[model samples]
Target: MSDAERQRRIAEAAYHKARERGFQGDRHLDDWLEAERELDRQEPRRP
Candidate 1:
């Protein structure tokens, strides 16, 4: 996927994660990073 699509997926995942925790506190950036890591883990690395 393109960078924009990857970012969109990460944002969506982060939003769901935040919602799952009741949307409290200031963890949006953390959520996004974690989501990106999770997505990265699911895909094979490109050389």
Candidate 2:
């Protein structure tokens, strides 16, 4: 996918993660990183 698409996916994943935890605390960075890792593991990007 393109850069924009990849970012969009990551954003969506992170949002879901926050929702899962009831939107408590300040874990936005953690959620975003976790989401990126999850997506990368699912399908590694090629350079």
| Cα-based lDDT for every prediction | 0.91, 0.98
Candidate that would win on TM-score: 2
Q: How does residue 27 of candidate 1 score in lDDT?
A: 96
Q: Estimate candidate 1's RMSD in Å.
A: 1.2
Model 2, position 26: C-alpha lDDT score: 100
Question: Candidate 1: misplaced stretches above 4 Å?
Answer: 45-47
Tens digit of per-residue lDDT, candidate 1, span 1-47: 77788889999999999999999999999999999999999974465
lDDT of 2: 0.98
lDDT of 1 at 29: 94
**How far in Å is the alpha carbon of 23 misplaced in model 2?**
0.5
lDDT at 20 for candidate 2? 98
Off by over 4 Å in 2: none
Which ten-residue region of model 2 has the weakest summed lDDT?
A: 1-10
User: Residues 1-47, candidate 2, lDDT per residue (tens digit)?
Assistant: 89999999999999999999999999999999999999999989989
